[model samples]
Target: MSKHQKIVIIGGGTAGIMTAASLSKQKLKIDILLIEPSENHYYQPAWTLVGAGTYDFEKTVRPMENVIPDGVNWLKDSVVGFEPENNCIVTKFSGKVDYDFLVVAPGLVYDFSLVPGLGEAIDKGVVCSNYTDPIHTWKVIQEFKGGTALFTQPTTPIKCGGAPQKIMYLAENHFRNKRISDKSKIVFATPGGVIFGVKPIAETLMKVNERKDINLRFGHQLVKIDAKNQIAWYALAPNMTEVNPKELEISTNEGLVGIHYDMLHTAPPSVAPKFIQDSPLANQEKWLDVNLHTLQHTRYQNIFGLGDAAGIPTAKTGAAIRKQVPVVVNNISEMITSNTIGDKVYNGYSSCPLVTDYGKMVLAEFDYQNNFTPDPKLKQMLIFDSSKEHWRLWMLKKYGLPYLYWNKMLKGIDV
Candidate 1:
């Protein structure tokens, strides 16, 4: 069936719901349709705590119907293809949906197949990831008998870049409490050269790594896993420039390195959803092409994109979406009412609550340039230096943020 909406939102995720709710608050007298396939909505930021045995997994989720805005029409279907020229979408469950404007926030898709042996071994035995199964991760951590515990980060952009290491710190804390720290060797293998993007936070995290004795292996990417043999293989990233010809020559000859692990936690590689990748609106990188500042589609003014799917340079996190929602909503409303884009610009503001230990977190807020950008209100509310690890930030991560997300952000209260 072909039905038309004044505004059609693809994906009932954090971005879509907030946009609809924000629009609804304006009382724009426009019909909004939200398309999503999942029956549940997840508060993904808390997954790190869930994997570390701090937060409940059930609390991170809610019925999709419960969070959807009051006035928006919910289409319980997945979009298979986009027809931007006709201003309609082809869905798997619903035949066709036509719209005056479209909002794309379908988020990224996890590709386990990117790593050989990962697709078959994930959430099985000692191989577990917080992204897929936090319960299994907790179980893996619980059953650990003090050996090499390896946590890996993929080369691809993940939802929360700090998550791969968050659980590692928690596991280290767990092992210390269990008196197995001496017996366990915790190693963080990542492709990035530093622990974090921001300098101050990275410097602090470097010290945290030193304090925890967590071995950091930079310029390494997970290429394969041998679940049966309990071996994880990594490919060393090639040097871009041949500064020292002899050193570069030696490094280039290296092969896949293997490490034995008793416990392994990984954040799988992620990419744009196939539907978004196949669309005409996708950028060269296969992500939804939107103006980074305006959150408006570059090619089609009527289309807006946000959340993880938007091809923005900043780190993809829920906190980023929290800031992005208002920008997209206001611009869309202005366009509908004034027939011109809003002047308000998004400064590429995004945040990551880096959980350092059981009761401590480093609230890392930054902009596109990787400069530390703390929320003054958040700083005042928590009453602590956001750059330093504090229990207050942990409390915010464990309790306050989730509450704010459900009650205020999703409700379009704009906190």
Candidate 2:
């Protein structure tokens, strides 16, 4: 390694750009290089509102050139392969670039094809996922007149677990607005037993479910979809045992384990990209293997990771990235100064603003330990306060959050 460090950041999404901004502000004597294939950088959380017809898709994205910090070098190319042994990454257009330190933030890949007939259903207007770009979500909702409108969550972890429910709430509200609430049937099918991960929110969601007349299909896994027949099938596991209230052992056999749906809003199985999957930096489970506390590579010391790519067992949301970026930036700085990743530790802090409806959200915050915590004392707390259904949070999601993301979070402005 040279006297001055050379840092390479792949994927200029939320994590990549924010880390760059944060590191640049520290004024480290280092050369920062960022590689990204996409010309457009998206505030992905905003896509949920876009799918609900509350915001425009065009407004959800900004040019990548604008978001990249002023001092860093931006490589407009995809990383085809990683040569972690050489401390370098091979780009598609540009050849190999070596680095003293590497930061991989390539977001998780959504596998829509994992569930049979999902591709066909998406095309045939029977399926829609907010996670995808060029989203036709509102069209899918508009096509639904009656019958069962199913929302599904896969066994695999997703970026925003709450997002599946967010869309469901919107669809339920849509049916109510159209005076079709009684006529339309809404159901939630999940591999998990509960609606929300946090208990307080889950308890509240149960009440919301009853009021909305939504059926809860627990221990149900989506296996196939028949777009032609407008039928979606899920594997049934009745009398399944689960730890309820986050700890108490309980079993429920009454809920429908296997249920069919007329129109399905599916959240596809997601994972780290194939390039990272093939690299040594990947965990035994095939995720980018990084220290849960430091966000530094477990096996490779020079390589660090954050965002959805990291193997940290937490909810992979932008809220999580907001917490992880600082830990990663600080630790990387320590590594540069001491020729090793110092003792800076991440508390495994991650957050998810569980948007129950257009106006209601339960801000679920917790550390990596999975211990239940409704609140944590961070400099900038993303609060999902007691106001489950309020115009204020809706306005925040609609107007304030994006402004904060672009101007503050992405720009490295303190919250």
Candidate 3:
């Protein structure tokens, strides 16, 4: 006999756990099975702070068993394939598992191999990434003695678009505190033409760059790293076609340029997980093909998706998952009770807390259209301008948000 569940949730990350918790609290008496292989769950937003030596690395993780919602079955198995046509999933250990409804939230994968020599360079002298090991990142930053420090952003979509720069700002603060700012050359090399996608945030960041005396290299994508020689290679990305006088673009057609650095911090290129990419649920871009608003699968009515792997046009941050969890849960509830998808829709809301310095941050919140969409509740809570860097926002990032996440968000209480 095949194991079966009324509702099957894939991946126990933020999206899946939150969804399961929300459903468990509801009066709906459907049996829920969550398929996840990992033994521990991570609060990834804190990794940036951890890398900057602002937070403890251990605080960002917890036993997976501790967070799995009560009354839900936890299947410690990996999903290798999806049989959406028959409402079944193929797992590596459990074999075939049938479901009445399915939720896909396997998250995304970081492709360090995309950059030649990068895989071997991580956590090895002078080269580190917050995405991989925040502890080693802090170690590298602490041990730096002031030379050409290079921070890079990959061309591929990452979890937090602003993360690459957040660590840089912290390192700048660290270098300044150590009286090495004058001797160090801080460079931020990114593939994007603008410092930030949102114009207001970008303008604010430009001012920060000026204040920090950081060298901004736009239209540059990291391709390779010579770890032993401490050299980084970049390919010139195409210029922005949109004619905005306020925006600037590099007009160089130079095929490649190599820069020598004493220290390097980079986020590896991110892509959809291989299983999701190989599945039929994936779109042309290989992301989970879901209705952006409803979070429901386009082809399969019984399936829904959220989080980084979903094809939502917004920054893939934990704040995005916060808004998405409610939408997906409500829609699934409607489908179960009324046999119709709910009208509750996701607005593609995403937030990136850009840590500018030791105790200041610019809370960049936006929607699908890239409009500055700050949380009204957060505005009232902090009582400060989120567009500008403020210590209150930093406190929110450092203290308040973590409490809210562990206590509220994971428990499925919509904050």
TM-score: the better of candidates 1 and 2:
1
Number of the top lDDT candidate: 3
Error of 3 at 297 (Å): 0.7
Residue 258's lDDT within candidate 3 is 78
Score every model by TM-score: 0.94, 0.90, 0.95
Lowest lDDT block of 10, candidate 1? 242-251
- The local lDDT score (0 to 100) that residue 349 gets in candidate 3 is 91
Residues 120-142 of candidate 2: C-alpha lDDT, one tens digit per residue: 56634667888874268778887
Which candidate, 2 or 3, has the higher lDDT?
Answer: 3
Off by over 4 Å in 1: 1-5, 239-254
Write one digit per residue (lDDT tens) for candidate 1, span 70-112. Answer: 9788999999998888989999978989989899999999888
lDDT-best of 1 and 2? 1
Q: Candidate 2 versus the native: TM-score?
A: 0.90
lDDT of 3 by residue, 317-410 (tens): 8899999998988998888778899989988899999999999999999999999987788667655668898988889999999999999999
